[model samples]
Target: MSLPKSNLQKIIQVSCAIIVSEDRKILVTQRSASMSLPLKWEFPGGKIEKEESPEQTIVREIKEELNIEISMSNKLPSVTHHYENFSIILIPFICKIEHGEIKLSEHQAFRWLNPNKLLDLDWAEADIPVAQYYLQTLNK
Candidate 1:
């Protein structure tokens, strides 16, 4: 029998920001053509660097990638997915923009989408479960 994904020897830890607006829309970004998983849409955040907590990573990444500061509101359930060559555990947090206008620097495109319509885009595999969980939370 194969090992459970959690038992994988090299699982990567990634942080995700679910930037929600007062109107219930969430920010989403599409990967640049030169990035891995090119063209797949994902939430704005990045890999957790050494010595940085998931929270710190999101704050720093959002500023660097979108030029905005955000306040974390809640922690969503984390999702783990196995790709062809690796696996990742995505830790998601609900966030609100604290200041500054967004100016995308790493993504090819971005959108403010109603939560219900998020699945309409082609999402990176790791984000699929996180999006589903976020949507389910809205129904409860």
Candidate 2:
């Protein structure tokens, strides 16, 4: 049987973000044409499946979307954003890719960028706040 309608509606979405740093630059992934917001940049992640915790979801999603294995530790402040089609409660986490290669499966492109250059690209609505907060914290 399928999930109950109200239960499904209450299902909160979670995502993992690895501000994978090298020389103080962070990694960003561009959503593919098939995604909800095509070409819009976001931290790499996907839906948190049933029976999985947010941390588990992040690890699984990173492997599925980026073809990389990540070790997530320490949760960042979560962000809640509403979209035209659906609302998402994104749990941002600080993670590091401990293994695997950079492979873009669901995204079209990827970039390593510093905070100063982050504003140059159009970010996904949900990710805009995260990027802004990241910059603010970096500047302090």
Candidate 3:
């Protein structure tokens, strides 16, 4: 059941990476079956820790989760989404890989999809708006 306003859970602050290649492909990862969202697709990232800026969160999370170092090129405004059990403020970053190769430790799969094709995959609830916002930015 969704949280009642009086008993709301803390809003988790998360940082996500929209890793773009020189050729304009964007990297996305599928949540492992054991993950909360199961096999849904999303831009890779994790929770922001204490004392971390959203940019710092992206770099650290990418290294730990995707095994790569990244440099942020731009940041989208944070999007807050409420799921049945919790809520999140998802901060999205537009970035490019600076080093290392990917060796997924937590995801079930990944894909480098062209921007226009992002909507083709089933996305996590929290990611739907971020993806839509990104696509809107592209058309402008």
Please report the candidate that would top TM-score against the real structure.
Answer: 3
Runs in model 2 deviating more than 4 A are 1-12
Q: Which parts of model 1 have CA positions greater than 4 angstroms off? A: 1-9
Q: Per-residue lDDT tens digits of candidate 3, residues 63-93?
A: 9999999998889988999887789999999
Which 10-residue window in model 3 sums to the lowest lDDT? 1-10
Question: What's the TM-score of every candidate structure?
Answer: 0.92, 0.85, 0.94
Query: What value does the lDDT take at residue 29 in candidate 2?
Result: 94
RMSD of each: 3.0, 4.2, 2.8
Tens-digit per-residue lDDT, 1-140, candidate 1: 99997666677999999999988899999999999899999998998999999999999999999999999989998888888778899999999999999999999999999987999999999999899999999999
Screening candidate 2 with a backbone cut-off below 3 angstroms (N, C-alpha, C), the clashing residue pairs are: none
| lDDT score at residue 126, model 1, on the 0-100 scale | 94
The residue-level lDDT of candidate 1 at 90 comes to 96
Local distance difference test scores for all models: 0.94, 0.80, 0.93
- CA error at residue 86 for candidate 1, angstroms: 1.4
| lDDT of predicted model 2 | 0.80
Ranked by TM-score from best down, the candidates are 3, 1, 2
How big is the positional error of residue 3 in model 3, measured in Å on the Cα after superposition?
Answer: 10
